[model samples]
Target chain A: MFMAPPATDIAPRDPLLPRIVRLRGKRREIRGVWSLEVVAEEGEPLDFAPGQFSMLTAFGVGEVPVSVSGRTRDGIGLVYTIRAVGAVTAALCGLRTGAPLGLRGPFGAGWPLEEAAAREVTVIAGGLGLAPLRPAIEAVLAAGGRLVLLYGARGPSEILYPADLARWQSARRAQVEVTVDHAGPEWHGHVGVVTRLVPRARFDPDTALALVCGPEIMMRFAVSSLREAGLSDARIFLSMERNMKCAVGFCGHCQFGPHFVCRDGPVLGYDRLAPLLRIEEL
Target chain B: MEIHDLEEVLRGHPFFEGLEPQLARLVRGCARLQRFDPGQRLFREGEPAEHFYVLRRGRVALELSVPGHETLVFQTVDAGEIVGIAALVPPYRSLYDARAVARTVVIAIEARCIRDKCETDPRLGYELMKRLVPVLFQRLRATRLQLLDVYGAPGD
Candidate 1:
């Protein structure tokens, strides 16, 4: 029989355990950041909505919260288009194919995928924000809803996940518009913030749900733009970002007013967060 | 810069005052910069007490979980404050998780390093103890306020 270790001997090990299995993907260059389509190493199906996120940990370094980008049959794939900011992210940037990393949770509340099951859906992703909204778009298409995706980036160089986006657009025959802040020599698309594309799309917001994610500045503009486009606060949803350590509610790090972003959000309707959303600093 | 630069940033902090310059520098050396966006966690309950942190900017909320009930938010740590010092003492492990409520910056110092340095130099350790006691008292007071928030009658 194997002997058990003493309680004191195992003291102080990291408390968090990886709930979602992480799989390695062949890194592909997408705009300025590297894109990795991470699938579940364990084959557990990820049933998440548009704006839910997972906490990806590079052991011995740290963990970060990322949006789930794609939901496929083999396993749920996460498209990580990360900016090399901190120690953990910097270390993640150096990882190559077949490199192992830890995955924990499809944590936080996702877009109301279940609630919006039958409604028309509009998803707006600005810059790297596309990483999280990808799953929502996929879910809409799978559910056979009329879905439109509006993607905006700083320029041609910052667009993320070309192959996946192209496949979804062509296969589903969904409307996907690509906009840029500045166009390069080879670029031929609308040039402006993502909000500019709102006018071109046709979605009856009163009966539709609009999900938006991007930089805080962009999200603010997007929300207001949707409202201006006659979308009610309750009909529009926005994904909020903050540094989340524990994807669980146990950590108070991701609190906005009385809500925990890691638990209550990553996705919140404009009606719920509208008051705090106006508070510029928070 | 030396420890005084750290002290200036943490001016009015009770945990480092009256320390000898040399010893103060040793404590400061262990600290590093940390930053967080709105709605991020610094640590969680039941996690190892690895490092104690001092807030430089932003807000941190401390939350405690109670069985069969909603988790209670105990307190908020604002800018220019020190937290997680108790984790530096014996039986180190966080009692509650510390999290950032807004875009926050902090200085985190490894408690083990400070503990080792304190063991090697008792005199400096004594100064640290004196400075740290009042902070502990303040935490206790804040925790009491939280208890009232949790248990007191809604209108009371």
Candidate 2:
């Protein structure tokens, strides 16, 4: 059975002195996106599942909840694909190797891999949404089940993890179909909304479980498209986001209706979120 | 198939399935078998709308071009799907460049012939319009989603 991290363990450390971690390596994934590999300065590697996020504090700069993008197959370090979008994130992105950053819990429920076993898996990611879904994709592929990933970005230049996508496709680990909303010369792939790729994915809709993570509007449309393709709401999951201040449920910032995105989910069943997702500006 | 059997073959397609036999014959009358070599331009964007195609084999890419950039393929219509519905609409002009991505076979139906038949047979016109609506709606929905730029940065 899946177990969530204890709140006590993930709660901010005194809200003053957070656990310090050191960035071991970093690479620019694409323009405005950086992949940071960090390790605990002292102690075992941070334990996290696919879809979980960590509250990374850049000491004086501030903290932000960046999803754990990847874990080494042998599980040595945690990886985060950070988009330099805001103050905290831009600070984190600016850090160099060996920079000390505070780290918090790998909080939030993860993708339901246990339920995904023996079934075809469809992963739909848009823009930075791919960061959180990367681990799940790796897990699903490692488990040897059929996997299909429908990913979209604004343009070819914005697609994260191009090499990994190519590897996944060449290794036959997954059927990864990528699309861009806009493209220049030299891009031969599909150019349209990510949802357009849904119909082209090979899967048994009735037996497939779809894990979607993207902007809310994208997820909304993706869920509708999946439902249209015959996947029940119960079988489709979404990774939701809000103004998350606390990694635990205490803070109300991440609340969506009655649920705390920090605790009940960053990952939630579409059935549970369908009604709330429709409300404007919730 | 022989020209005499074209109606039977067209009827077998899901798009034409359950079409009235008489209407099917009339549609077949407007259609002619056409082949395109790989990478050939079937039609260019902004060209006068003259014909639409029901693909019989291979793929056709519907692409849009920005003046200085490479053309972007927004959608691809494969065998058994129809392309160039813009030919049937008012102010008719091809909306995107259609190119054969592979050696392709299609039933090319002249817009004038379809318009003439529709004007002569209201029932057939209604049926054709009914079928075309879904295709047009699907395209419109996709365009709406693209316009949303759903993959771009989130709102603050």
Candidate 3:
């Protein structure tokens, strides 16, 4: 049995002070997105599940919650994929190797991989949504479970981890189907929404577990398509996103109805979130 | 297979499920089995739409071409799916290229014959329209999602 990390019990009085870590390496994924490798400056590695996010602070510039994109099987260092959408993320993306930064808890629930054992797993990712799902993909592949990945991007130029995708496809580690919304003349791949590829995936709907991460609208459509394909709501999971402040539940910035995204989820069952997802600007 | 055998196949298809026996027979009258090799272009964009197909085996890709770049596949139609609905709708021209990606067998129905039958039999026309509406709506929804570029940067 794999040893899981102890859950955080005490709410930090100063969540920023004791959380400092150092960035070790960086790799650009696309135009504005990057994958940064980080490690603790003084202690043991941080253990995290696939869907959890860590609160990353850039000392002077503000802090933001970035999902832990990857972790060693031994639960060593962490990998974070950051999109330079705002000031804090932009700062985090700009830092070079050996840069000092603040890192907090690997908060929120993760994909229910234990329940998915021996069952077929379907992973659907849109845009940068692929980052948060990468860890799950790695775990599933390592376990030699039946896996299918349906990924969509803006175009060929915007695809993330092309090498990893190629390796997965070439090695037959998983059934990887990739699509783009649009592409130039040289592209000869699927050019439509990611949900369109879900029907083509080979899985026993009765025994399959689907994990989706993407824009809310995209996930909504993806979930609908999966349901039509015969998967139950209980077997469908989503990694949600919101403007988050404190990594813990104290700050109410990441509230979704009765649940706190930081603590209750970054990964949640679709059945629990469907109703709240319908309300506008909630 | 014989024409009667093809008719039996059509009857078994979900697309023709609940179709009136007489209408199914009429549709079968217009269908001719056609086979395509891999990489074969069944129809090209802007071509005058003459026939639509009920795919029976293998896969066909619907592709849109760009002037200076590669062809982008919009969708793939497998067994039991219909292709070239444009022949049934107005502006009778293919909007994209349909190419067989594998050895494919299809029951091709002449658009002119089907249209003539529809004009003569209002009931058949109504039933066909009702079924076609859902497929059209599905395509519309998929197109709308593509236009939103839901996979792109959230702010963009």
**What DockQ does every candidate get?**
0.01, 0.54, 0.48
> What is the docking quality class of candidate 3?
acceptable
- Model 3, residue A91: distance off in Å is 1.7
Candidate 1 vs candidate 2, TM-score winner: 2
Q: CA lDDT of A191 in candidate 3? A: 64
Ranking by DockQ: 2, 3, 1
lDDT of 1 by residue, A1-282 (tens): 999876684454243686444546645465225655566665545555557777777768988887776654365466666666568876776677666777767677888887666888888888778878877777788888878788876556667777767876785537787766543323334444566577657788788888888776667767866887899988888889876888788878888888888888888888999899768777
| 10 residues in a row with least lDDT, candidate 1 chain A | A182-191
Off by over 4 Å in 1: A1-15, A19-23, A37-50, A76-79, A171-173, B1-156
- How do these models rank on lDDT, best leading? 3, 2, 1
Give the lowest summed-lDDT range of ten residues in model 3 chain A. A11-20
Interface RMSD in Å per candidate, to 1 decimal? 22.1, 2.5, 3.0
Error of 2 at A172 (Å): 4.5
> Candidate 1 falls in which docking quality class?
incorrect
Give the lowest summed-lDDT range of ten residues in model 1 chain B.
B145-154
